[model samples]
Target: MSERKPVVLVTAADLAPEALALLGGYEIVYAGKTPSDDDIVSLCGQHDPAAIIVRYGKVGAAAMAAAPSLRVISKHGSGTDTIDKTAAAARGIAVRAAAGANAAAVAEHALALMLACAKSVPLLDARMRAGHWDKAVHKSLELHGRTVGLVGLGAIGLRFARMADAMGMNVLGFDPYAKELPSFVQRADLDTLWKQADVISLHCPLTEENRNLLDAKTLARCKRGVIVVNTARGGLIDEAALLEAVRGGQVRAAGLDSFAVEPMLAGHPFQKESGFILSPHIGGVTSDAYVNMGLAAARNVRGVIEAR
Candidate 1:
């Protein structure tokens, strides 16, 4: 008799057929919708999966404690902020992330946001639809001669740097963790980058040290009329300070995909503020990104399961 293949539990949304097919003959268990902590614990108590694929939901201590058979966790994307890494490590569960899969798509989305902000695309479209020509609304700034400061020169940040450089923008990067700077990017201290950049793009993770990294003091350091783009974590920028900067003309425009509070509450400042381009955390929502991330996560889970 053949040995039974280990079961893999998917706690997130259903994956594409292509992603599922990549798992070969592994037993797949789909946990329909995200269950509460108690429900997750109870369900796992019964179904004891060998591996769990997680996305967009918290997997707490209760759930982990319930699944003694779980050996690996494959996160669907780069950010493991939602996952309790320390607890997982203590439990001897290997945690894996599809880090590089969505870099290009996210970088492209950042550029798109910058372009839309620079051209005031949303405002223009809204006015034209309201039967206002508004032709004399002054010309928008060109990106050709601007300096782009990037925070965190990781995969997504480097990609954004390359794109900005290709568009004739001087690229400056600040990442204390990076051992060496990319050839196309100039390395700068955080203070210098903050003061000199015409456009600043954030691509760092959320951590205690980086939380509210761009508070009132940092905003004051930025060049007046600087454009800011944040496709990274929301906590990196102080939301209230960001709003104050925009209102006070310290920041000319901001392109934001993530917010301090996601699914941004109705009547948020971003909605009321002019020259602010907001996207609903769609930086990595492109079809290409979705396939890459889903497939990579599936493969990681499969590899770990088979190895064990």
Candidate 2:
């Protein structure tokens, strides 16, 4: 009799064909889009997967406990915040991430957000659609020679720094754990960065220590009219505080790709604010990045399973 193939569960509706090919030997099971925690746990209990490739929804300790055979949890993208790392460690399950798989795509999105905020692209487009020509009264903020401050100089942050540097912007970065930075990037403390940066961008993972890093108090310290961009996690910012800052003109504009809540609730205050530009966390959703992340995740899964 033939033996059962080892099960590998993916926490999304689909993965790239190439990635699936790489794991041909394993039996793949997918949890549909918008999977709830309960769904993940149920799937784990049913599949008893040897590995899990997370693409959406949170993987809590409960799910980890459901699959005693689970050997690894590999993130489809860079951030592993969605996975409960502590619980995995306790159960002897390895946690890994496909780091830098979406770096280029996310960095480009950050740059687009910066430009959109600085030049009021969405606002201008709306005005044009309304048959109003404000070219005579409007002035766009030129990015050249401006200073851009970056938080979390990891892969995405470093890529953004390079783009900003190329545009003649002075790049100041704050990442305590970063080492061997490029000559174009000047390392600075948070206080200095807040005071001097004309533009601020976030590219760090979310952690308990840094939740609400850009709250009312911190936002108040930044240069008035500073443009803010976040392509990272949404919990890093205080949403209500950001809305108030925009309303009060303390922050000229904010470009946010991630929100504190997924698919932000209807009639959120930011929805009414003209100074805010938002995307549905699609910074890393490009076709190229999708394939890259999926492939990396599959390879990571294979590496762990084969080694054992």
Among all candidates shown, the one with the greatest TM-score: 2
Whole-model lDDT values for every prediction: 0.86, 0.96
lDDT of 1 by residue, 81-161 (tens): 767888898999888998988999899999998998888898888889999988786588899978999998999999999
The whole-model C-alpha lDDT of candidate 2 against the native structure comes to 0.96
lDDT of 2 by residue, 114-171 (tens): 9999999999999999999998999999999999999999999999999999999999
Worst 10 residues of 1 by lDDT: 34-43
For all predicted structures, in order, the TM-scores are 0.93, 0.99
Model 2 spans > 4 angstroms off: none
Superposed by TM-score, candidate 2 places the C-alpha of residue 5 at a distance from the truth, in angstroms, of 1.0
